[model samples]
Target chain A: MTDATPTFERSPDLPPPASTVGVVGWLRQNLFSTWYNTLLTILALWIVWEAVPPVISWAFLTADWAGTSRDDCTSGGACWVFIKEWFGQFIYGRYPIEERWRINFGSIILIVCAATLFFPRFPYKLWVSLFLIFVYPIVAFFLFSGDAFGLEWVETPLWGGLFLTLVIAIVGCVFALPIGIVLALGRRSDMPAVRAVCVAFIELWRGVPLITVLFMASVMFPLFVPEGLTFDKLLRALIGIMLFQAAYLAEVIRGGLQAIPRGQYEGAQALGLSYWKMMILIILPQALKLVIPGIVNSFIALLKDTTLVLIIGLFDFLGMIQAAGTNPDWLGFAVEGYVFAAFVFWVLCFGISRYSLHLERKLHTGH
Target chain B: MAVSSEVGTPPARASFWNDPRIRAIIFQILILGGIILFGIYIVNNTLVNMESRGISSGFDFMGRTAGFDIGMTLIPYDEASSYGRAFFVSLLNTLLVSAIGIFFATILGFIVGIARLSNNWLVSKLAEVYIEIIRNIPLLLQIFFWYFAVLRALPSPRQSFELADTFFLNLRGLFVPKPIFEAGFSAILISFLIGLVAVVFIARWAKRRREATGQQFHTVYVSIGILVGLPFLAGLVTGFPLSWDYPALKGFNFQGGMTLIPELVALTIALSVYTASFIAEVVRSGIQAVSHGQTEAAGSLGLRPGPTLRLVIIPQALRVIIPPLTNQYLNLTKNSSLAAAIAYPDLVLVFAGTALMQTGQAVEIIAITMAVYLTISLVISAIMNWYNKKMALVER
Candidate 1:
């Protein structure tokens, strides 16, 4: 051995142990390896230092956490005071200032209904949800627009801000899912006529920008209808958003439909299952599970797209910020208002994204 | 088994639409009739309405002189210019914003995507924060923030910040040196083109040699050398035919260097930042989609990390990346239309909002605007699809 009879000191095929290999090793290799990496580290740190403190200061630190008026905001930070004062309007819109409890109750019902649908342990869940879904719109209508029950009528125009956005998005999602499923199936049908019609319908809506559709609904929709017929601008915009969103939702569902094996489709046919029977009994349940993440993604997009209504003269959260910031007294508060609005948007979208991830994990099919 | 019974037909029936396809033909006839009737009704109503209003319509109005001052234009445009020219100017602005946005977004997105995959805790978390914060917010809101809140707060023009004695920055815009080419410039350009072709040929030859002889040629180094050398050589031969025209200080605003408005800058930056978060996700997924086995196999063959990434990983990962990357590019382009909200003179604002109102040609204006977007989307999709098919998985 000492004479060195070609003793092979073969290189190991892999890296060393955890101490020399994984995360710690990666840090040494990536972050502090060279003059350039060290320089990058310092520059990145400087960027954080420059951007974060001011954001934190404006968002929370030295910010007025509680106040009812702009006058009460003595600190040189965000006037969350304005948000606090207008919080009622933001959530319930212009539902008469005195009758805000009606909206509060309606929201409570919505929350309880949502909790029941999401909670697997809840008893008679589907029946309860079905019952609640059917009842709530009527209940909410009477509670919010109360002319029928000797309460004051709250016009749809009075609905604005977060309340309108949430109602529109949630309602749109609820309506679009079923329509999307139908359209997806139509798109996949063997009949060329049916497929062509579905394709044209979906593509035509998808091709035009959402803002134009909203404009068309707001301005041109009335002309399209018969004389003496009137439509609420808010309702029209909501419909426009729903129709546009449904097309995208159909594509997402189609992806899920395609994922089911042909063997399963053949098996369903062998079992003599009718088209509707095979679909509802087997295919749809499985496909919806597969594409829950896609649906949620579309939902997030629709939620963001709802802000386009701001351009059409509706006061969503963003529009509210824009309108409120332009006030005489709060003339220079555009930055603060926009920042607050952005945070609200970021939180809602981020929350949905996190849920989508959790749902994906829970429903993992192991691609 | 019960197919015949469900169809309420005799056993061994071959056709679903068996009865001379009467149901199908009837349905088709109804559809065609309804469509034709609807078209006629719309046409008749529009004609009657136009005549009643005593307004003429057509492309004739497009050639009519547009009498409005546009704040920005890429080419020489005046108030007396045709509406068609105004439309083109607006389209140019939109293209400028979209092109610049796509370029920066791709760069930032890839960096952030790689950052997210890093083992370093700070970097991954920072990337997560960036994506969540930037992507969730409405793009329209960000544009407004840049236009009204950020850029609007800059100091006045009189206190403009000067840079390198050839550029100026103010609330109005950032002005940089604009080149006024002399006669020799075209000669240099020709030399540059020749150099580019030579480098490509050299690269191909070097690659063939490397494959045949198993010897490294450093194609990248050679190409860079030729590219730089030829350009410099041409410049010298042409008597160094380039000079910068400094943006001289004037009474109110800086004069001369190509002036870029705050609106354009704001729109570009906001679109890039907003779109990057999404592109980052696409890039991250594309990288992750490439199985780790490929990289490990490359490393085992004695390839260094850089070469492993460049030669083994990127080519494969890009096959996955290009599809979604194209999507983000399309989204960014479409989202650039929102610049109109901030008065960025994008096609949407100038053509759809302003020109429509001026001409009262809602149908025509909207159609043209929609056609432009549709054309862009289709062309991009077609090119991307072709590339995607070429890169698609082959079982063999």
Candidate 2:
């Protein structure tokens, strides 16, 4: 209780010791913290040293970039000239040179439509999305096929390379979304028969490989239809892709549906909303938003799986590369072709995943 | 009297269309009717079309001769083999590649997963880069790259890459010295199995003793010693009855060794590497899902880091990891079908590709191929479910 006046002045804080304060400190704490860690650090450094420089020198420093033929690639390094020589074939695979602009125009419109969705201030966001989802596909199809718009008629066989890959992936996803939603709803329906049918359909597709599905579509589909009722090869493959993708998308949407709180359903029901109205107006918007990342991931998967169309004899981007690699003139350029394809695929997949992550972050609202 | 009257009065009945129960039944009936009609239409059209094309359909074709050659097969096969036998051979090939891929992928995945969570920044970043780059590339592209670009670039057999005079790798394939087991080799195998049984028993005994006496035993070290020593002793007693058929360079190519076809090596490597990236992500998320408080609590209980991880963290993490790990395994199995693209003689290629082409029995062959894959998927998932149920938390 005594108010004593005996006091001591406090010393100002000193900087942390050198071993715990800077780059060396970080290295000490993170890399060389223990015997095993130090060993691991050395091993990692060894791996990097063994791998990085050779790759860099081969890929960049010694690569032949500005050449027009196989003979122009005499550097004993990567011959990017091969990729350059076949760039047209790789991008538009035997697509008539004059008619390539249609694909370009369609892609530009798609990009614009996609871009509008990202703009928060856009007034016609919903309309733009609907057009991209519904109307743009038919327009793009007509533009590419050229039978309806007075443009030059390019047969489906000529649809190859990245253009065909984009078409299959975009159309597959755009069509699969509605089908998947319906399937998801059916699976969760109160009606026993509807649920059973949906379950059977989903499992039938999910349990088998896509290769088999494509085989069925290509070989068996002809028999399934009446005689002389020929479908385009590309159309058959697209149908196969859509059915396969819808099953996976249905599962993902079901996950979203399950995640939605039961109270939301009760509230909608309490407000005298019919099941369809409740779903369209209240339940679906929230559920779909919650699973945007999942949807994008599935889209990325569909894009990758589009390569399987090559087995059915449709030359997608990978297929084009495979065909070009086996060309007699470009015999030994498989390495370059594959590397380029890998780079393109990596960029696209990485970009989509990053966008998904961004959307997930933006849409995340705490309950 | 008023309450009784209210309870006794029946509610007003809505129209049949407005009744939810009647509507559900009607909706379901409509869907069922549509499906049935569609099925009948398809079957009728298929019958007529097949008759017109002269394509007979049934499983009877499975008994006919396959009349084709497969590059790599586990069982003895030739052109005279029945289509059924060819199916099995290709199925075994598919299973072989899948098993090897799963084995390697699991090991690589666990390593990368642990590395991603490493304290070393460089290691984690390196692991991250590996996962990102490998995950994005298509598996088929990777297979083609490996087979056509890398393996095909290897020197011819005359100038093959040799490893310690036992392994030879060239453009044709990878050649490893095949083991020649002598008559007494079964003794060593028997001893190994016996040692495994003994270790299990010893483990149980040690656990019981520890519970009763409050004492610990080094069961792991003891089990390892018995497992290795018993096998070694048996081998020594049997005069080490084993020999190696080294892959020596013959006139035109290497001989006297097991040659793994380039197609298989390529497909296996691609499938494993791609699947490993996904498994690594699953493993990382699983370990992350194990709360930090668990680690701290273990530390407070006087357990070291390694034991804390093995005894506490991994068990819980595995509960999260197993389901997704099963999914990746199923994915690897399904993706193995891509082997057809490279003409690897897998089931899809042998049965669905060649057999269907020869017999023109597309419906039967494709259905069988799909059924095989579906069966495999179901079996794996069933096993996974059993494991999950066994590992599920026990609540009082």
Candidate 3:
């Protein structure tokens, strides 16, 4: 009966209090909000202070970069001259100077092909990828190990450094993928015998370390082959790496296979598609899409594992550095050599991982 | 009518080539046959090759003397030790390094993992950088860096980097005080064992009491107190029968104290640091997997942050964390083979490298090495499967 006409008017929201906004507020909230946080902040700062400057001085500020020999380094810091001088060997190993152009050209083709495949807007992605997967390896093999086209033959032993590292990683992953897919399929097949064989193969390779596998390839493998039919050291190492990586890849693919819903299988069966047709046309595409991150991760692991070939005496990037560091002329430059190798590897791996993360984000369809 | 008749009766038999079951059988037979033939070929070739190369194949070489000196060993090993003994020595060294690596990696991993999720910006960034840098670089490179660049750069024993005059760091290796347990040390050890049993009982009793009455007990504090206090009391009563064999500078090298060879140090550091990166990622993902709603639920129930974490969050997180954490452990164990690169005299180095070289028994030696690793992998995977089943969510 007596409704009051008076009402309160809402005012525009006031800006947050000064103490709870901007830079100071941010610092207080993130770094010194609690007693322990403040203590940790101080500790972290002290650690950074203690560690960062000396490294900077040693690696950059006082380091000798523009130099030709050990004598040219006089700043009492890292002799980066060692890395600069041996850069060629670190990259191409003992690859002949004239033949280095083949490596560069092949790698350029690889980069272009890879770019086309990864580029979302590019047309003919499938064809480019097929070329990369099938044709490029043959071309690269002949190009690098030239016994044709009137080019001088560069034996596998002469293949070392980053060039050899990439060769092993690329070849290993490319070959392992098909074998891994087959093994993964066999592992999931209805036939128990097929499953058993696949399981044994995968487990046998997965169980042992790559070093032991390479050792077997080097020493024991010759015994396994026919007499007088010797294999190249690098070829043996490559085969060992491929088989070992395939097992790991198979496991990853199996995970992807398992993640596929049973409904997908039922749907395929309802369509009266044969098993091979169903898997090839329907299941694999979806499953592989779901596990691109896993595949890329396995590839990254394979790349890092390529370093194990060095243990068998094939001079990969790290091996070349190890060799160079021991050179009488470059004595005491191990630090610089290692730093350079670490940086190169870090760049490659970190770049690939970042790309994988990007792809993961891009492909994250709602479940 | 025809369709109905077909449905009512069994369908006509498909041709043998088109029969799924028949196809499957044929395929499996083909595969099995191929594998068998391949095996036979390999064996025949191996026999011929071995004969031609004069490389005898057998386990007889295991009994022969290993005429190489292991730079580091857990047991008595010299040029005269049998290859079998050398294998055991190397195996022990592998286990020793792996144990130490796992312990340090777990600790560092957890800390970094927690820090990665910390509210502090700089701390999280630092953790991220550490994980990224450590993981991206190949472990072998890191080992080389530590062994050749850093450790080898240290001054000689004459100019050792001394810590409290008991620990010495030089080009030779790390020389630390070795604990020498005397006569009455057994009393302290017995007390520790007793304390461990007491803690288990106390923990069980506290849990039962908490269930019976809605009250919490200070189980952790009490258990820790007992565990530490019992040993200290025993030591005090027994006059602390322990001594440290302090390293002293001898003519040109360190003497007395136990020496950790540079190889071991480098291997351990490289392994722990490298593996800690992966473990950190596993832990971060695990903790993140436990939904935030659980925290709020615990808060609503009057639980504090610490108890919420220990009782509510971590238990769930562990179900996700344990499988991957154990995988990392297995990876670390396998990776310890990299010690061969640095001449650490690990299994692959001593048995697979040196023994195989000396005996020319590549097949036997490599086979044995592979089998050992396979056994390890199988055992670990078995443990992982058990743990996975146990920790799996038990839903109605």
Highest lDDT against the true fold, candidate: 2
Q: Identify the superior model by lDDT, candidate 2 or candidate 3.
A: 2
Model with the higher TM-score, candidate 1 or 2: 2
lDDT of 2 by residue, A231-315 (tens): 9899999899999999999999999999999999999999999999999999999999999999999999988888999999999
Could you say which candidate leads in DockQ? Answer: 3
TM-score of chain B of each: 0.91, 0.96, 0.94
lDDT of 2 by residue, B111-148 (tens): 99999999998899999999999998888899889888
After superposing candidate 3 on the true structure, give the runs of residues whose Cα lies further than 4 Å from its correct spot.
Answer: A1-14, B1-10, B213-215
Comparing to the true complex, what docking class would candidate 1 get? acceptable
Model 1: residues with Cα > 4 Å off, grouped in runs? A1-39, A65-74, A141-147, A365-367, B1-56, B210-215, B393-395
Which run of 10 residues does model 3 chain A get worst, by summed lDDT?
A1-10
Compared to the true structure, candidate 3 yields what TM-score? 0.96
Write out the backbone clash pairs for model 3.
none
Per-residue lDDT over A164-262 for candidate 1, one digit per residue giving the tens place of the 0 to 100 score: 888778888878888899889888977677788779878777766787777666755554444455788888887888888889899999999999988
Candidate 3 lDDT tens digits, A107-145: 999998887777679989989988987798899989999
Q: Compare candidates 1 and 2 on DockQ and give the better one.
A: 2
